[model samples]
Target: MDSTKCQDHEPSTKLLNPEGPTATIRPIDFTRSPLADDYSSFFAMTIDNLLTPDECARLQAAAGDNWQTLSKGNAFRECQNILVFSPEWASALYDRIVGHLPEEVKALRKGDRLAEIVVGPSHLKASVGARKTVWRIKEANDRLSFLRYQPGHHFKPHCDALYARPGKDERSFLTCQIYLNDAPLSADGKSDGGETRFWTSQVGKRQKPPAMECEPAEEKEAPFLDIKPKMGRALVFQQRMLWHSGQEVKRGEKFTVRLDLMFERHFEKLQPNS
Candidate 1:
């Protein structure tokens, strides 16, 4: 696909911030299957030029002043920093997202179908002679986080927390990530290995998912999905079900913005497992 054409076609709207510079949202012209039969109607979509290069650079610069090392349980190896946008900016962006959502998605939200709402359609139809699918954004976390991954930095394979605990009212359903810049090039003139890797199980109904190491495997029997970070690209997927990780950076640096799309689900009986 022509990056120039995609960039030119992006709709200029007051979605992200009405007062500040406008943000664009464009559909990705790619094909990716849903995770399972149950989620066949649901869509996982990636959009390009969601944030312009200038916007990404500004966010990256803001994060530089306050880079915080992230931890996984007790390990402080996973590194990142949280970015807090102004209240006006946040509210405007959220409202713009709500405005762009398709009617079907709005109906699901109105019905309080938390499960279906979490994995709603993408709303983007396939190109000629291609399969058809729909995509949409049901919700997003109040805050956005900026992460910087330098050489050798990586996040191990793990599923995101399903629920945000009782009384929190917020339950994590999907993860949305936007790349600030392209993957750094190496001495060989090739992009470094900082792709996000997703793992799936071969055996049916296993008690737990298989474990993934800090580094990428040369080969694996189970199904896997690898996504390369590119400037202005955004990826959204099921956070609780997909086992994924941020691969180790081989050179330069990788920056991204991570946001969780959540909903309020009140459990009648909160069990330990629930």
Candidate 2:
């Protein structure tokens, strides 16, 4: 038998859409948000209309094989890191491109068969990608997505980056989270739980630290954006600069997808010029 014929696996040659153009995340000019006060949390913001109900349903259906329970041992004691179980819908979405690429990337792309369930023509009109404000950090060192699962079973506290292994620029950039399911605990009419909390840190502590030891804060309040986990709603921010956490699931189970991006050293200038 020919070796090519005998082989069941083949290499993929799909050229990804060129890491679109450079995108800038800015603060609302009208309102004074803490997020606007400092550039540390600059890479972060929330986007609505990323997905629709139909698309969420499709993702839930696809998210089966990728589903895993969030273990307590792996849960973040100080920062918000926890393994989450993908919902049936999200599991379905995970299955769509298991081999094509990383599950998180597929989840973020808007044209997958599963994604079209809720993706409307206008969905991308004002989106981060469409606006070309978020230029994919194409450096070889750019950070990719990390698939995570958080059941209604867990919660994490306010802290900065952790769980990221060694790689240039990985820890130095921003973090964006896309909600896969509307958690019941999520209020504010956005979605449910699986909230992304933004916290306030104490003075004289401007360095990033490991996510274990409890760090005392001068004071803290509800997240600047207590995001509800709505499918396609992306929460963006600087992972290391923002003292944020995954709020506990109180009502129903939640499903979420996470991705972290590291920008070029000088691109931080594109950040809010605080």
Best by lDDT: 1
lDDT by candidate, in order shown: 0.54, 0.39
| Candidate 1 lDDT trough over 10 residues, lowest sum | 1-10
Q: Once superposed on the true structure, which residue ranges of model 1 sit more than 4 Å away at CA?
A: 1-42, 73-77, 83-89, 95-139, 163-170, 187-189, 201-221, 264-274
TM-score for each of the candidates: 0.62, 0.49
Across residues 60-119, which tens digit of lDDT does each residue of candidate 1 receive?
564445566665654424666656543433443445344433444433232234334343
lDDT of 2 by residue, 165-217 (tens): 35542222334565766656435644444566555543345443423224434
lDDT of 1 at 153: 85
User: Distance (Å) between predicted and true CA of 9, model 1?
Assistant: 31
Error of 2 at 95 (Å): 19
